[model samples]
Target: MRRLMICSFLLVLAATANAAQPIRLGLNYPSTGNYKSEGLELRRGALLAIETLNRQGGVLGRPLELISRNTAAREEKARANIEKFAAEGATMAFGGATSEEAIAAGQRARELGLLFFPTLGYANAITGHDGQRYLFRETNSAWMSARVLGEYLSWHLPNRRYHYVSLDDNWGHSMEQALREATRSRDRARHGFSRISARGARHEEYLAALKKAASSDADVLVIVLLGQDLVQTMRLAHDLKLDQRMQIIVPNLTGSIVEQAGPQVMEHVIGTAAWTWRVPALVKSEQGQAFVDAYIAQHQRYPDSTAASAYAIVQQWAAAANRTGSLHSEKIIKALEDHRYSLLKDEQYWRSFDHQNVQSIYAVRVRSRSEIMQDRFKQDYFNIIHRMDGEAAAPNLDEWQEERGDELSLR
Candidate 1:
């Protein structure tokens, strides 16, 4: 009887050991900072992807686990999260939507030799940094987005002069430089219109500066602020009645910004981003519709561009992991560069040269409460006019270098 019991115990132990899984993933982003709303959305979307992947079957026949860390909107916290992720045996790190955070996370990925997949922050440096492989941006950079926006402006409203309202920071300056270069040759280009500092909580000062712009001949107002700043500035603009006169333009600002600014302020507000699930092509696809449905069911609301963008990136990451057949960072990085499969909802190619996941940017307009009441706002918050191809939008090394040069000189 004792020998039989011992044999049974040994069999149970061996079975348990054989069934254990190995690969782990880490997600680093702000869950309680300036962009907490967006950051949380990113986490939720990524978590959804992780759950879905695990449900089907994890990578390389092992159940995958995810450890998420919050940046808390602090650089030290962001760095700490990176170290923790590495120390915790994470082979790859997923992060970003803000340029500063993306670069900081990428730097850590470089030092630790972990693959970092950036979702939101579109700083140009990720791809440029002398061909660094540690960082890979799943979405187009602010550099590419700005260039596309500029070209759209030139093509759609050729005769109109352009004006820029940029925050005094790396993000603002890089985006501004992209626009400047895009519109460099135009004689009517209204360059250097207004420079605002993004270093405050309350935005009365920004309101006053914008009020002055309202008085100017600048018909096209390009705002480069997101989240609270985007909401507050739009609120002040509406209070000051700037929307009735000028065409307001902002890039990569999501629908959550619209919701936060409230229906009154966000009405007639125009913005651009990679892809909103609200778009028709996205809504019709299986993955796109499923993502939207799941997000709405879980969060009880429509997801903004920030949420959609992060979700798209998470899906891309999972697909790459599954295809690579290994959780090793180097293998995953190479798989990302290879980019074997297409995201069910995406409509563009992932360029191998710079690891820029190329997709068309969508331009959107906010609907009024009146419109929503009339049931006219059920459609996507943004209307899609065209899809810009990657080849058409990507700049050569020389152009990228020139843009960076202009940026350094500005500082």
Candidate 2:
């Protein structure tokens, strides 16, 4: 009788301990698709953060475990993966490499009532309409980046005639609209916008269009396309002898683009971004250096925007979890609203209204390998293009309610 009672007590204690374990976090990303490289890097960064957090004794005294799923950059795959994650008891999910995939994932997440953190999808649909309760994007929206680029162009290159060659997708369209509005508000004649599909062999057609536009006296070329598309487009432009004819500006060019296009094609191309692998000494605070060093050590390579976003987001989640002492959605959300934690030295803090993290912008001009080797690089992108105040970045609740948000019935 005594042995039986002791065994039963031990079993109960083991069960209780198991039950008290920290909840698992689900990470959905494109692990086997066009953007698989970005996904792998992002996952590596996320794991680095998670490992660091756990080493520091984790949240609520229980170590965190990740439940990862791959989307393959396909809508059907993403939807299926989402369901799989949900069924596997994931409290939340984070994803969005491409615009279409991200939008679909966001809409589905909202429909399923899961808290989804978007890493690097620039589409506006995620947080555009009633994105308060479920969706939290630590990344800047397409509008945010577009507005910054517009303001910068207005100030610096006011005399130059700007022609836009943008990707014809949700992300590109939203960004184009924002850029168009901003440019038109300043001076309509200075800027013009055009569309191009990032996928397929539309390069010659687009190049011909660009050539015609240039012939009409367009001076500056602003390209809004993905890394792969940008590589192809730039190569085509270079072959056509069009690049040397115009000043090129690429807003969302990644390190991967440079790697793809090689040193030759990327030269003289200026880009705006949220983060980079090369951290300048002037901007390298202890925290920033630590994050950079940690990432490099873990991944055995330089960190890009995708990696930075994933790491930053995980840090954000950890901070929120630690502060709240609970992984529950409401508590974590409230903790994020406080914005008291320092996720990184980049000052990438979250906004309460829209739940978007307002981070600093960097303007980088592609340099030759020899120039890069000489370490003669400017740390700041464009001498502080725009310090987007979080308050200004905050979307109006009433305005959001009017635009499809009001109709969203999230029960």
Candidate 3:
């Protein structure tokens, strides 16, 4: 009997030891779909963060593991993935290529009591009306991007006619609305607008959108589509000679998108980014530069804003977890809220009211094909025409409250 008791105690100790293993960091993102390339970048950057953190002995003396589920950029898939992550013992979860995915996944995460940090969701509603205690957005909102881009438009291209070809999704609508408000072109009739499905859009649907925009006689064409869809549509736009007739603006631009669509296609396109690889040197951030170096060493390419966001998500979460020395979601959320951080860029912080990461945003114009090809990797993508501070661009307290529609004292 004594011998049997000793064996049971040893077994229980072994089980406890197994339970003390590394914390699982869940990544629910699209692995297949229009945003597959973006999803790959999220995983790549997160892996690099995990490697660096493990090398440094990890957070709170525990190693970290990345567990991801493919969302295919679908809302239902994202919600289901979050539930799976929670059931699989994920301490926290983060990943979303689109604002729709982020918003849906974040809501589900809240229901499951998991802390979620979105890697690349840009709609204001992610941290606005749809936001909750469980969600923390890492990217700037469409309003913020619109604010910076609008300033340049106001000065350079006042009174220009505009046409908007946006995706029929949360992000697309948010960006289109924000840009319209920014440029003071609220009349959809005066500024022609067209929208295609975010996923599974037919070839003719894209061609039809461009043909309509071309016939509208607009001086500026704002293209809010993304990923493979953007690449396909840009080629169609070129075929329709829309690129030559209308100046193009693509919000939330990334180097990956530019790289996928050759420099000739993306040439002269204007956009905004939270962090381009060149931003590190532009901002004189050594840590950011180191991350760039490490990323290049492994991937042989410049890290785009999406990748930077994924990296920042991992590092920031680990820091918060370490600070609290507990894996409880509430404690970590409180630790991250209103915390100032400087990583791949200059000073940035999580806003207390909405949990949006506030930082500088840039107005970037794609370099000409000739200028881009002159680079070593031919990845010279943007010339920063202007920069705007986060504080100046993000929604003020009144605006946030109006959007949130709640009466709660500042947390």
Which structure among the candidates has the greatest lDDT? 3
lDDT of 1 by residue, 131-179 (tens): 3567767676766776767677777766655567676666777677666
For each predicted model, how many residue pairs clash, with residues at least 3 apart or on different chains? 3, 1, 0
Off by over 4 Å in 3: 1-20, 406-411
Over the stretch 357-385, how does candidate 3's per-residue lDDT look in tens digits? 99999999999999998888788799998
Alpha-carbon TM-score of each model against the true structure: 0.86, 0.85, 0.94
Angstrom error at residue 316, model 2: 1.4
lDDT, candidate 1, at 15: 74
Residues 225-278, model 2: lDDT tens digits: 774567777887777666788878777767767766766677778766676665
Q: Between candidates 1 and 3, which one is better according to lDDT? A: 3
What stretches of model 1 exceed 4 Å from their correct place? 1-19, 183-189, 280-284, 374-380, 397-411
Give model 3's TM-score versus the native structure: 0.94
